[model samples]
Target: MATPNELTAMRRAIAISAQGLGTTSPNPPVGCVILDRDGVPVGEGYHLRKGDHHAEVNALTAAGERAEGGTAVVTLEPCNHHGRTPPCRQALIDAKVSRVLMAVMDPTSRGEGGAVVLEQAGIEIERGVLEQEALLVLGPWLHSLSTGRPHITWAYGVDTDEGHSNQALTELRRRHDLVIRRDGTIEEGVPGGHGADSFRVPLPALGDEPGKALHVLTESGARTVLIEGRSNEAARLLADAVDRVIIDVPGTRPSFSLTGPGAESAVPGGFCLSDVKPSGYRVRLTAERVTQDQ
Candidate 1:
Protein backbone atom coordinates (compact mmCIF):
# COMPACT_ATOMS: atom_id res chain seq x y z
CA MET A 1 0.00 0.00 0.00
CA ALA A 2 1.17 3.53 -0.80
CA THR A 3 0.74 6.19 1.83
CA PRO A 4 -0.55 9.60 0.80
CA ASN A 5 2.81 11.06 1.68
CA GLU A 6 4.54 8.53 -0.52
CA LEU A 7 2.18 9.31 -3.42
CA THR A 8 2.79 13.01 -2.98
CA ALA A 9 6.52 12.40 -3.02
CA MET A 10 6.21 10.34 -6.16
CA ARG A 11 4.27 13.13 -7.88
CA ARG A 12 6.91 15.61 -6.87
CA ALA A 13 9.56 13.32 -8.27
CA ILE A 14 7.64 13.13 -11.55
CA ALA A 15 7.61 16.90 -11.80
CA ILE A 16 11.29 17.00 -11.02
CA SER A 17 11.91 14.51 -13.80
CA ALA A 18 10.29 16.89 -16.31
CA GLN A 19 12.94 19.49 -15.55
CA GLY A 20 15.38 17.34 -17.56
CA LEU A 21 13.32 16.99 -20.71
CA GLY A 22 15.01 18.04 -23.97
CA THR A 23 18.40 17.87 -22.22
CA THR A 24 18.30 14.26 -20.99
CA SER A 25 17.85 12.67 -24.37
CA PRO A 26 19.28 9.13 -24.79
CA ASN A 27 18.88 9.05 -21.01
CA PRO A 28 15.48 8.89 -19.40
CA PRO A 29 14.61 11.69 -17.04
CA VAL A 30 14.39 10.42 -13.45
CA GLY A 31 13.61 12.05 -10.10
CA CYS A 32 13.92 10.96 -6.50
CA VAL A 33 12.72 12.02 -3.08
CA ILE A 34 14.14 10.72 0.18
CA LEU A 35 11.67 10.41 3.01
CA ASP A 36 12.49 9.66 6.62
CA ARG A 37 10.84 6.72 8.36
CA ASP A 38 8.13 9.02 9.72
CA GLY A 39 7.13 9.92 6.08
CA VAL A 40 8.74 13.34 6.14
CA PRO A 41 10.71 14.27 3.03
CA VAL A 42 14.37 14.84 3.79
CA GLY A 43 15.69 15.67 0.33
CA GLU A 44 14.85 15.63 -3.36
CA GLY A 45 16.74 15.66 -6.67
CA TYR A 46 16.37 15.12 -10.39
CA HIS A 47 18.69 13.80 -13.09
CA LEU A 48 19.75 16.87 -15.06
CA ARG A 49 21.44 15.22 -18.04
CA LYS A 50 23.74 12.47 -19.19
CA GLY A 51 27.06 12.20 -17.29
CA ASP A 52 25.51 13.83 -14.23
CA HIS A 53 24.86 12.11 -10.94
CA HIS A 54 21.73 9.97 -10.90
CA ALA A 55 18.74 11.30 -8.98
CA GLU A 56 19.11 8.74 -6.17
CA VAL A 57 22.73 9.70 -5.62
CA ASN A 58 21.97 13.41 -5.45
CA ALA A 59 19.02 12.92 -3.12
CA LEU A 60 21.01 10.59 -0.94
CA THR A 61 23.81 13.10 -0.81
CA ALA A 62 21.39 15.78 0.29
CA ALA A 63 19.80 13.50 2.84
CA GLY A 64 23.18 12.37 4.21
CA GLU A 65 22.88 10.25 7.32
CA ARG A 66 19.14 10.93 7.51
CA ALA A 67 18.59 8.47 4.65
CA GLU A 68 19.21 5.47 6.86
CA GLY A 69 16.00 3.46 7.27
CA GLY A 70 14.24 6.04 5.09
CA THR A 71 12.01 5.44 2.07
CA ALA A 72 13.10 6.46 -1.43
CA VAL A 73 10.38 7.51 -3.82
CA VAL A 74 11.60 7.59 -7.39
CA THR A 75 9.94 8.13 -10.75
CA LEU A 76 11.79 5.21 -12.35
CA GLU A 77 13.48 2.14 -10.99
CA PRO A 78 17.00 2.85 -9.78
CA CYS A 79 19.54 2.06 -12.47
CA ASN A 80 21.70 -0.97 -11.65
CA HIS A 81 24.27 -0.60 -14.44
CA HIS A 82 27.42 1.46 -14.57
CA GLY A 83 27.58 3.90 -17.42
CA ARG A 84 28.72 7.45 -16.92
CA THR A 85 28.06 6.90 -13.21
CA PRO A 86 28.04 4.04 -10.76
CA PRO A 87 24.89 1.98 -10.15
CA CYS A 88 22.23 3.73 -8.08
CA ARG A 89 20.97 0.54 -6.42
CA GLN A 90 24.25 0.19 -4.55
CA ALA A 91 24.01 3.80 -3.49
CA LEU A 92 20.61 3.25 -1.90
CA ILE A 93 21.84 0.11 -0.16
CA ASP A 94 24.94 1.90 1.05
CA ALA A 95 22.74 4.71 2.36
CA LYS A 96 20.91 2.14 4.44
CA VAL A 97 17.54 2.94 2.91
CA SER A 98 14.97 0.50 4.24
CA ARG A 99 12.21 0.84 1.55
CA VAL A 100 11.84 1.85 -2.08
CA LEU A 101 8.80 3.10 -3.99
CA MET A 102 8.99 3.40 -7.77
CA ALA A 103 6.47 4.48 -10.39
CA VAL A 104 7.96 2.75 -13.43
CA MET A 105 10.34 -0.05 -14.33
CA ASP A 106 13.56 0.60 -16.18
CA PRO A 107 12.87 -0.47 -19.75
CA THR A 108 16.46 -0.61 -21.01
CA SER A 109 18.27 -3.91 -20.94
CA ARG A 110 21.73 -2.56 -20.26
CA GLY A 111 21.34 -2.68 -16.49
CA GLU A 112 19.90 -5.39 -14.37
CA GLY A 113 16.63 -4.07 -12.87
CA GLY A 114 17.27 -2.36 -9.57
CA ALA A 115 14.23 -3.85 -7.82
CA VAL A 116 15.77 -7.30 -7.83
CA VAL A 117 19.04 -5.97 -6.49
CA LEU A 118 17.36 -3.95 -3.75
CA GLU A 119 15.22 -6.93 -2.73
CA GLN A 120 18.34 -9.07 -2.49
CA ALA A 121 19.77 -6.45 -0.13
CA GLY A 122 16.71 -6.94 2.12
CA ILE A 123 15.01 -3.63 1.32
CA GLU A 124 11.23 -3.53 0.97
CA ILE A 125 10.04 -2.51 -2.51
CA GLU A 126 6.75 -1.22 -3.86
CA ARG A 127 6.15 -0.66 -7.60
CA GLY A 128 3.62 1.30 -9.69
CA VAL A 129 2.67 3.83 -7.07
CA LEU A 130 1.84 6.44 -9.74
CA GLU A 131 2.89 4.83 -13.00
CA GLN A 132 0.62 6.82 -15.32
CA GLU A 133 1.70 10.20 -14.02
CA ALA A 134 5.33 9.17 -14.23
CA LEU A 135 4.81 8.19 -17.85
CA LEU A 136 4.19 11.84 -18.67
CA VAL A 137 7.87 12.35 -17.92
CA LEU A 138 9.10 9.11 -19.51
CA GLY A 139 6.81 8.86 -22.56
CA PRO A 140 9.08 10.52 -25.12
CA TRP A 141 12.11 8.42 -24.26
CA LEU A 142 10.03 5.27 -24.19
CA HIS A 143 8.49 6.17 -27.56
CA SER A 144 11.90 6.74 -29.06
CA LEU A 145 13.13 3.45 -27.69
CA SER A 146 10.20 1.53 -29.13
CA THR A 147 10.13 3.20 -32.54
CA GLY A 148 13.83 3.94 -33.07
CA ARG A 149 12.95 7.56 -33.82
CA PRO A 150 12.70 10.74 -31.90
CA HIS A 151 9.35 12.13 -30.85
CA ILE A 152 8.76 15.11 -33.14
CA THR A 153 7.08 18.36 -32.14
CA TRP A 154 6.36 20.84 -34.92
CA ALA A 155 6.37 24.46 -33.72
CA TYR A 156 5.33 27.29 -36.00
CA GLY A 157 3.16 30.37 -36.30
CA VAL A 158 1.46 32.62 -38.85
CA ASP A 159 3.07 35.85 -37.67
CA THR A 160 6.70 34.93 -38.18
CA ASP A 161 8.24 37.63 -36.01
CA GLU A 162 5.76 37.26 -33.17
CA GLY A 163 6.01 33.49 -33.30
CA HIS A 164 9.77 33.56 -33.09
CA SER A 165 9.49 35.91 -30.17
CA ASN A 166 7.13 33.66 -28.25
CA GLN A 167 8.81 32.74 -24.98
CA ALA A 168 7.40 29.23 -24.95
CA LEU A 169 8.86 28.43 -28.35
CA THR A 170 12.21 29.82 -27.30
CA GLU A 171 12.18 27.69 -24.14
CA LEU A 172 11.13 24.63 -26.12
CA ARG A 173 14.05 25.11 -28.50
CA ARG A 174 16.47 25.39 -25.62
CA ARG A 175 15.39 22.10 -24.04
CA HIS A 176 14.89 19.86 -27.06
CA ASP A 177 17.67 17.48 -28.13
CA LEU A 178 17.72 18.89 -31.65
CA VAL A 179 16.20 21.75 -33.61
CA ILE A 180 15.37 21.59 -37.32
CA ARG A 181 15.71 24.75 -39.32
CA ARG A 182 15.23 25.47 -42.97
CA ASP A 183 18.56 26.28 -44.58
CA GLY A 184 19.61 29.94 -44.20
CA THR A 185 17.00 31.04 -41.65
CA ILE A 186 19.20 31.18 -38.56
CA GLU A 187 21.45 34.20 -38.91
CA GLU A 188 22.91 33.92 -35.41
CA GLY A 189 23.58 30.19 -35.70
CA VAL A 190 21.33 27.76 -33.82
CA PRO A 191 18.95 29.33 -31.32
CA GLY A 192 20.11 27.05 -28.53
CA GLY A 193 23.77 27.53 -29.46
CA HIS A 194 25.86 24.84 -27.73
CA GLY A 195 23.05 23.46 -25.61
CA ALA A 196 21.38 21.77 -28.58
CA ASP A 197 22.46 20.56 -32.02
CA SER A 198 20.86 22.05 -35.15
CA PHE A 199 20.10 20.58 -38.55
CA ARG A 200 19.29 22.57 -41.67
CA VAL A 201 17.26 20.71 -44.23
CA PRO A 202 16.55 21.84 -47.76
CA LEU A 203 13.08 23.22 -48.47
CA PRO A 204 10.66 20.42 -49.08
CA ALA A 205 10.24 19.18 -52.60
CA LEU A 206 6.59 18.96 -53.65
CA GLY A 207 6.38 15.25 -52.85
CA ASP A 208 9.35 14.71 -50.59
CA GLU A 209 8.89 12.10 -47.95
CA PRO A 210 8.81 13.34 -44.38
CA GLY A 211 11.12 12.04 -41.63
CA LYS A 212 14.22 11.20 -43.71
CA ALA A 213 16.31 13.83 -41.98
CA LEU A 214 14.68 13.11 -38.65
CA HIS A 215 15.51 9.42 -38.98
CA VAL A 216 19.17 10.35 -39.31
CA LEU A 217 18.91 12.52 -36.20
CA THR A 218 17.31 9.76 -34.15
CA GLU A 219 20.04 7.38 -35.28
CA SER A 220 22.48 9.89 -33.78
CA GLY A 221 20.63 9.50 -30.45
CA ALA A 222 18.21 12.45 -30.51
CA ARG A 223 15.09 11.59 -28.53
CA THR A 224 13.16 14.83 -28.98
CA VAL A 225 13.34 16.88 -32.17
CA LEU A 226 11.70 20.29 -32.51
CA ILE A 227 10.76 21.64 -35.93
CA GLU A 228 10.98 25.42 -35.90
CA GLY A 229 9.74 27.06 -39.06
CA ARG A 230 7.05 29.08 -40.81
CA SER A 231 3.71 27.81 -42.04
CA ASN A 232 4.81 26.16 -45.26
CA GLU A 233 7.55 24.19 -43.60
CA ALA A 234 5.19 23.21 -40.80
CA ALA A 235 2.67 22.07 -43.39
CA ARG A 236 5.31 19.93 -45.04
CA LEU A 237 6.26 18.32 -41.76
CA LEU A 238 2.65 17.78 -40.73
CA ALA A 239 1.90 16.09 -44.05
CA ASP A 240 4.58 13.56 -43.25
CA ALA A 241 6.21 12.98 -39.89
CA VAL A 242 5.39 15.49 -37.14
CA ASP A 243 3.91 13.85 -34.06
CA ARG A 244 2.69 17.03 -32.39
CA VAL A 245 2.06 20.65 -33.37
CA ILE A 246 2.22 23.91 -31.48
CA ILE A 247 0.91 27.09 -33.04
CA ASP A 248 1.46 30.43 -31.35
CA VAL A 249 -1.36 32.86 -31.89
CA PRO A 250 -0.51 36.42 -31.02
CA GLY A 251 -2.75 38.48 -28.70
CA THR A 252 -5.85 37.46 -26.79
CA ARG A 253 -7.87 36.78 -29.89
CA PRO A 254 -10.27 33.89 -29.48
CA SER A 255 -9.03 32.45 -32.77
CA PHE A 256 -6.27 32.91 -35.31
CA SER A 257 -5.68 31.85 -38.87
CA LEU A 258 -2.70 30.46 -40.73
CA THR A 259 -2.29 31.78 -44.26
CA GLY A 260 0.33 30.83 -46.83
CA PRO A 261 1.01 28.36 -49.60
CA GLY A 262 -0.04 24.86 -48.42
CA ALA A 263 -1.20 26.31 -45.09
CA GLU A 264 -4.70 24.91 -45.53
CA SER A 265 -3.28 21.46 -46.18
CA ALA A 266 -0.68 21.57 -43.40
CA VAL A 267 -2.35 19.32 -40.89
CA PRO A 268 -1.80 16.11 -42.93
CA GLY A 269 -4.69 13.76 -42.25
CA GLY A 270 -5.78 16.01 -39.38
CA PHE A 271 -4.91 16.91 -35.82
CA CYS A 272 -6.53 16.63 -32.42
CA LEU A 273 -6.23 19.65 -30.20
CA SER A 274 -4.56 18.60 -26.99
CA ASP A 275 -4.28 21.89 -25.17
CA VAL A 276 -4.55 25.64 -25.51
CA LYS A 277 -2.58 27.59 -22.97
CA PRO A 278 -1.28 31.09 -22.44
CA SER A 279 2.32 31.78 -23.36
CA GLY A 280 3.25 35.27 -22.37
CA TYR A 281 0.93 37.51 -24.37
CA ARG A 282 0.36 34.86 -26.98
CA VAL A 283 -1.93 31.84 -26.89
CA ARG A 284 -0.24 28.54 -27.60
CA LEU A 285 -2.34 25.78 -29.08
CA THR A 286 -1.00 22.24 -28.97
CA ALA A 287 -2.29 19.40 -31.10
CA GLU A 288 -1.28 15.85 -31.92
CA ARG A 289 -1.39 14.35 -35.39
CA VAL A 290 -4.39 12.14 -36.00
CA THR A 291 -3.44 8.83 -37.57
CA GLN A 292 -5.44 6.96 -40.17
CA ASP A 293 -6.76 4.39 -37.76
CA GLN A 294 -8.12 7.08 -35.50
Candidate 2:
Protein backbone atom coordinates (compact mmCIF):
# COMPACT_ATOMS: atom_id res chain seq x y z
CA MET A 1 0.00 0.00 0.00
CA ALA A 2 2.13 2.87 -1.20
CA THR A 3 1.04 6.48 -0.86
CA PRO A 4 -0.23 8.33 -3.94
CA ASN A 5 3.17 9.86 -4.56
CA GLU A 6 4.79 6.44 -4.06
CA LEU A 7 2.40 4.84 -6.57
CA THR A 8 3.42 7.33 -9.26
CA ALA A 9 7.01 6.39 -8.59
CA MET A 10 6.06 2.72 -8.93
CA ARG A 11 4.55 3.32 -12.37
CA ARG A 12 7.70 5.01 -13.58
CA ALA A 13 9.73 2.11 -12.23
CA ILE A 14 7.82 -0.38 -14.36
CA ALA A 15 8.16 1.87 -17.41
CA ILE A 16 11.90 1.96 -16.98
CA SER A 17 12.10 -1.80 -16.48
CA ALA A 18 10.44 -2.36 -19.90
CA GLN A 19 13.36 -0.69 -21.65
CA GLY A 20 15.83 -3.51 -20.84
CA LEU A 21 14.11 -6.00 -23.11
CA GLY A 22 16.30 -5.96 -26.20
CA THR A 23 17.57 -8.91 -28.19
CA THR A 24 17.36 -11.07 -25.07
CA SER A 25 16.36 -14.37 -26.62
CA PRO A 26 13.62 -16.31 -24.78
CA ASN A 27 13.39 -13.66 -22.02
CA PRO A 28 10.48 -11.32 -21.49
CA PRO A 29 11.03 -7.61 -21.63
CA VAL A 30 11.26 -6.39 -18.02
CA GLY A 31 11.76 -3.10 -16.18
CA CYS A 32 12.26 -1.93 -12.59
CA VAL A 33 12.70 1.22 -10.52
CA ILE A 34 14.07 1.91 -7.05
CA LEU A 35 12.94 4.69 -4.74
CA ASP A 36 14.64 6.04 -1.66
CA ARG A 37 12.55 6.36 1.52
CA ASP A 38 11.52 9.83 0.37
CA GLY A 39 9.98 8.24 -2.80
CA VAL A 40 12.63 9.77 -5.02
CA PRO A 41 13.78 7.44 -7.81
CA VAL A 42 17.43 6.55 -7.37
CA GLY A 43 17.78 3.91 -10.09
CA GLU A 44 16.07 1.93 -12.86
CA GLY A 45 16.70 -1.34 -14.73
CA TYR A 46 15.62 -3.68 -17.54
CA HIS A 47 16.36 -7.35 -18.11
CA LEU A 48 19.45 -7.71 -20.30
CA ARG A 49 19.69 -11.42 -21.14
CA LYS A 50 18.62 -14.98 -20.34
CA GLY A 51 20.80 -15.57 -17.27
CA ASP A 52 21.62 -12.02 -16.27
CA HIS A 53 20.42 -9.98 -13.31
CA HIS A 54 16.70 -9.30 -13.69
CA ALA A 55 15.43 -5.74 -13.94
CA GLU A 56 14.80 -5.54 -10.18
CA VAL A 57 18.33 -6.56 -9.24
CA ASN A 58 19.85 -4.16 -11.75
CA ALA A 59 17.75 -1.33 -10.38
CA LEU A 60 18.62 -2.29 -6.82
CA THR A 61 22.30 -2.40 -7.62
CA ALA A 62 21.97 0.97 -9.34
CA ALA A 63 20.47 2.18 -6.06
CA GLY A 64 23.36 0.54 -4.14
CA GLU A 65 23.44 1.37 -0.39
CA ARG A 66 20.50 3.69 -1.14
CA ALA A 67 18.41 0.55 -1.59
CA GLU A 68 18.64 -0.25 2.12
CA GLY A 69 15.45 0.63 4.00
CA GLY A 70 14.05 1.93 0.70
CA THR A 71 11.27 0.69 -1.59
CA ALA A 72 11.54 -1.32 -4.83
CA VAL A 73 8.94 -1.03 -7.58
CA VAL A 74 9.01 -3.62 -10.35
CA THR A 75 7.04 -4.54 -13.46
CA LEU A 76 6.82 -8.27 -12.83
CA GLU A 77 6.62 -9.55 -9.26
CA PRO A 78 10.09 -10.42 -8.10
CA CYS A 79 10.53 -14.08 -8.95
CA ASN A 80 10.57 -16.28 -5.84
CA HIS A 81 11.82 -19.40 -7.64
CA HIS A 82 15.26 -19.89 -9.04
CA GLY A 83 16.48 -20.58 -12.56
CA ARG A 84 19.61 -18.85 -13.82
CA THR A 85 20.05 -17.12 -10.48
CA PRO A 86 18.64 -17.16 -6.94
CA PRO A 87 15.12 -15.96 -6.29
CA CYS A 88 14.77 -12.17 -6.48
CA ARG A 89 12.69 -12.28 -3.31
CA GLN A 90 15.75 -13.26 -1.26
CA ALA A 91 17.81 -10.64 -2.99
CA LEU A 92 15.37 -7.91 -2.02
CA ILE A 93 15.29 -9.13 1.57
CA ASP A 94 19.07 -9.37 1.75
CA ALA A 95 19.31 -5.91 0.27
CA LYS A 96 17.25 -4.70 3.24
CA VAL A 97 14.42 -3.32 1.14
CA SER A 98 11.58 -2.20 3.43
CA ARG A 99 8.76 -2.12 0.84
CA VAL A 100 7.98 -3.71 -2.55
CA LEU A 101 5.43 -2.70 -5.17
CA MET A 102 4.72 -5.00 -8.10
CA ALA A 103 2.75 -4.73 -11.35
CA VAL A 104 1.97 -8.24 -12.68
CA MET A 105 2.65 -11.71 -11.36
CA ASP A 106 4.92 -14.03 -13.33
CA PRO A 107 3.23 -16.81 -15.37
CA THR A 108 6.10 -19.26 -15.61
CA SER A 109 5.43 -22.55 -13.77
CA ARG A 110 8.71 -22.05 -11.95
CA GLY A 111 7.36 -18.69 -10.81
CA GLU A 112 6.22 -18.31 -7.20
CA GLY A 113 4.37 -15.13 -6.32
CA GLY A 114 6.90 -12.55 -5.22
CA ALA A 115 4.42 -10.57 -3.14
CA VAL A 116 3.63 -13.63 -1.04
CA VAL A 117 7.29 -14.41 -0.54
CA LEU A 118 8.11 -10.81 0.38
CA GLU A 119 5.18 -10.58 2.82
CA GLN A 120 6.36 -13.77 4.49
CA ALA A 121 9.71 -12.05 4.99
CA GLY A 122 7.87 -9.30 6.89
CA ILE A 123 8.41 -6.66 4.20
CA GLU A 124 5.48 -4.50 3.09
CA ILE A 125 4.25 -5.52 -0.38
CA GLU A 126 1.79 -3.94 -2.80
CA ARG A 127 0.40 -5.78 -5.85
CA GLY A 128 -1.70 -4.92 -8.91
CA VAL A 129 -0.53 -1.37 -9.35
CA LEU A 130 -0.78 -0.57 -13.09
CA GLU A 131 -1.21 -4.24 -13.92
CA GLN A 132 -2.81 -3.79 -17.36
CA GLU A 133 -0.03 -1.66 -18.78
CA ALA A 134 2.50 -4.10 -17.39
CA LEU A 135 0.69 -6.98 -19.04
CA LEU A 136 0.54 -5.19 -22.39
CA VAL A 137 4.28 -4.71 -22.36
CA LEU A 138 4.76 -8.37 -21.55
CA GLY A 139 2.17 -9.60 -24.06
CA PRO A 140 4.61 -11.08 -26.57
CA TRP A 141 6.47 -13.06 -23.93
CA LEU A 142 3.28 -14.33 -22.30
CA HIS A 143 1.77 -15.24 -25.66
CA SER A 144 4.86 -17.21 -26.58
CA LEU A 145 4.52 -19.11 -23.31
CA SER A 146 0.86 -19.99 -23.80
CA THR A 147 0.58 -20.82 -27.54
CA GLY A 148 3.83 -22.85 -27.79
CA ARG A 149 4.51 -20.99 -31.04
CA PRO A 150 4.52 -17.30 -31.84
CA HIS A 151 1.23 -15.60 -31.05
CA ILE A 152 -0.56 -14.14 -34.06
CA THR A 153 -3.06 -11.31 -33.71
CA TRP A 154 -4.12 -9.32 -36.79
CA ALA A 155 -4.33 -5.66 -35.86
CA TYR A 156 -5.12 -2.13 -37.11
CA GLY A 157 -8.49 -0.50 -37.83
CA VAL A 158 -11.83 -1.76 -36.45
CA ASP A 159 -13.15 -3.17 -39.73
CA THR A 160 -12.61 -6.27 -41.86
CA ASP A 161 -11.82 -4.23 -44.97
CA GLU A 162 -8.42 -3.31 -43.67
CA GLY A 163 -5.60 -5.51 -44.97
CA HIS A 164 -1.95 -5.58 -45.99
CA SER A 165 -0.95 -4.79 -49.54
CA ASN A 166 2.36 -4.29 -51.32
CA GLN A 167 2.41 -0.54 -50.89
CA ALA A 168 0.94 -0.62 -47.38
CA LEU A 169 3.59 -3.02 -46.11
CA THR A 170 6.28 -0.75 -47.52
CA GLU A 171 4.75 2.31 -45.87
CA LEU A 172 4.52 0.46 -42.54
CA ARG A 173 8.21 -0.35 -42.73
CA ARG A 174 9.09 3.23 -43.62
CA ARG A 175 7.02 4.35 -40.63
CA HIS A 176 8.47 1.48 -38.60
CA ASP A 177 5.28 0.47 -36.76
CA LEU A 178 4.88 -2.96 -38.36
CA VAL A 179 7.08 -5.70 -36.91
CA ILE A 180 7.10 -9.46 -37.53
CA ARG A 181 7.31 -11.30 -34.19
CA ARG A 182 8.51 -14.89 -33.93
CA ASP A 183 9.60 -17.04 -31.02
CA GLY A 184 11.08 -20.43 -31.86
CA THR A 185 9.60 -22.07 -28.69
CA ILE A 186 9.25 -21.78 -24.91
CA GLU A 187 8.45 -25.20 -23.37
CA GLU A 188 8.13 -28.78 -24.62
CA GLY A 189 4.34 -28.97 -24.58
CA VAL A 190 4.62 -28.70 -28.39
CA PRO A 191 7.87 -29.15 -30.25
CA GLY A 192 10.73 -27.26 -32.04
CA GLY A 193 10.09 -24.14 -30.01
CA HIS A 194 13.08 -22.08 -28.88
CA GLY A 195 11.48 -18.74 -27.92
CA ALA A 196 11.24 -15.60 -30.09
CA ASP A 197 12.83 -17.17 -33.15
CA SER A 198 13.46 -13.96 -35.08
CA PHE A 199 11.87 -10.76 -36.30
CA ARG A 200 11.32 -9.96 -39.99
CA VAL A 201 12.53 -6.49 -40.67
CA PRO A 202 11.64 -3.85 -43.31
CA LEU A 203 8.36 -5.45 -44.38
CA PRO A 204 7.61 -4.30 -47.89
CA ALA A 205 6.13 -0.82 -47.89
CA LEU A 206 2.74 0.03 -49.33
CA GLY A 207 2.84 1.61 -52.79
CA ASP A 208 0.91 4.73 -53.75
CA GLU A 209 -2.04 2.61 -54.96
CA PRO A 210 -1.83 0.11 -52.03
CA GLY A 211 -1.69 -2.81 -54.51
CA LYS A 212 1.65 -3.42 -56.17
CA ALA A 213 3.98 -6.17 -57.39
CA LEU A 214 5.87 -6.40 -54.07
CA HIS A 215 2.58 -6.90 -52.18
CA VAL A 216 1.95 -9.84 -54.53
CA LEU A 217 5.30 -11.31 -53.48
CA THR A 218 4.33 -10.95 -49.78
CA GLU A 219 0.95 -12.68 -50.34
CA SER A 220 2.91 -15.76 -51.35
CA GLY A 221 4.12 -16.12 -47.75
CA ALA A 222 0.74 -15.86 -45.98
CA ARG A 223 -1.03 -18.95 -44.59
CA THR A 224 -4.49 -17.52 -45.28
CA VAL A 225 -6.65 -14.39 -45.56
CA LEU A 226 -10.25 -13.45 -44.66
CA ILE A 227 -12.46 -12.51 -47.58
CA GLU A 228 -16.11 -12.08 -48.59
CA GLY A 229 -17.45 -13.09 -52.00
CA ARG A 230 -18.46 -9.49 -52.69
CA SER A 231 -14.95 -8.42 -53.72
CA ASN A 232 -13.83 -10.87 -56.38
CA GLU A 233 -11.05 -8.71 -57.73
CA ALA A 234 -9.65 -8.15 -54.25
CA ALA A 235 -10.00 -11.86 -53.48
CA ARG A 236 -8.25 -12.98 -56.65
CA LEU A 237 -5.50 -10.45 -56.04
CA LEU A 238 -5.15 -11.80 -52.52
CA ALA A 239 -5.49 -15.39 -53.70
CA ASP A 240 -2.61 -15.00 -56.11
CA ALA A 241 -0.70 -13.32 -53.31
CA VAL A 242 -0.87 -16.06 -50.66
CA ASP A 243 -0.22 -19.79 -50.73
CA ARG A 244 -3.81 -20.50 -49.55
CA VAL A 245 -6.80 -18.17 -49.72
CA ILE A 246 -10.06 -18.44 -47.72
CA ILE A 247 -12.98 -16.66 -49.39
CA ASP A 248 -16.48 -16.46 -47.86
CA VAL A 249 -19.40 -17.05 -50.25
CA PRO A 250 -22.78 -17.51 -48.53
CA GLY A 251 -24.80 -20.52 -49.63
CA THR A 252 -28.04 -18.89 -48.66
CA ARG A 253 -28.20 -15.07 -47.93
CA PRO A 254 -27.23 -14.43 -44.27
CA SER A 255 -24.33 -12.35 -43.07
CA PHE A 256 -22.44 -11.97 -39.81
CA SER A 257 -20.20 -9.19 -38.54
CA LEU A 258 -17.71 -11.61 -37.05
CA THR A 259 -14.47 -10.93 -38.92
CA GLY A 260 -10.80 -11.54 -38.30
CA PRO A 261 -8.31 -14.16 -39.36
CA GLY A 262 -9.12 -17.67 -38.06
CA ALA A 263 -12.63 -16.84 -36.76
CA GLU A 264 -14.72 -20.02 -36.72
CA SER A 265 -18.10 -20.41 -38.41
CA ALA A 266 -20.12 -23.21 -40.06
CA VAL A 267 -20.70 -21.10 -43.19
CA PRO A 268 -20.85 -23.14 -46.39
CA GLY A 269 -18.91 -22.27 -49.58
CA GLY A 270 -15.85 -21.71 -47.41
CA PHE A 271 -12.70 -22.80 -49.22
CA CYS A 272 -15.07 -24.59 -51.62
CA LEU A 273 -14.84 -24.72 -55.42
CA SER A 274 -11.51 -23.14 -56.18
CA ASP A 275 -12.73 -22.29 -59.66
CA VAL A 276 -16.03 -20.56 -58.79
CA LYS A 277 -14.84 -18.90 -55.59
CA PRO A 278 -11.51 -17.80 -57.03
CA SER A 279 -12.29 -16.82 -60.61
CA GLY A 280 -15.99 -15.97 -60.35
CA TYR A 281 -16.44 -14.68 -56.80
CA ARG A 282 -12.86 -14.23 -55.59
CA VAL A 283 -10.57 -14.09 -58.62
CA ARG A 284 -11.44 -14.57 -62.29
CA LEU A 285 -7.95 -15.51 -63.44
CA THR A 286 -6.64 -19.04 -63.69
CA ALA A 287 -3.06 -20.00 -64.67
CA GLU A 288 -4.06 -19.80 -68.34
CA ARG A 289 -5.81 -16.47 -67.81
CA VAL A 290 -2.75 -15.16 -65.92
CA THR A 291 -0.51 -16.48 -68.71
CA GLN A 292 -2.68 -14.68 -71.27
CA ASP A 293 -2.49 -11.48 -69.15
CA GLN A 294 1.31 -11.85 -69.31
Listed in order, each prediction's TM-score against the native is: 0.81, 0.54
How many backbone clashes does every candidate have? 0, 31
Model 2 per-residue lDDT tens digits across residues 1-294: 568866787667656654543333355667888888787888888875567788888888899999888888887778878777778888899989899888777876354477787898899988887888787566545654563433222212212333333343333322111223222111121112112223222244333332473343233221112222223233343333322222222222156564543222311222222232231222221111122333
What is the C-alpha local distance difference test score of each model? Answer: 0.75, 0.53
Best by lDDT: 1
User: Candidate 2 local accuracy as lDDT?
Assistant: 0.53
**Residue-wise C-alpha lDDT for candidate 1, range 46-81, written one tens digit per residue:** 887677788999999999999999999999999988
Clashing pairs for predicted structure model 1, backbone only: none
Question: TM-score of the candidate numbered 2?
Answer: 0.54
Model 2 lDDT at residue 225: 21
Deviation from native of the Cα of residue 218 in model 2, angstroms: 22
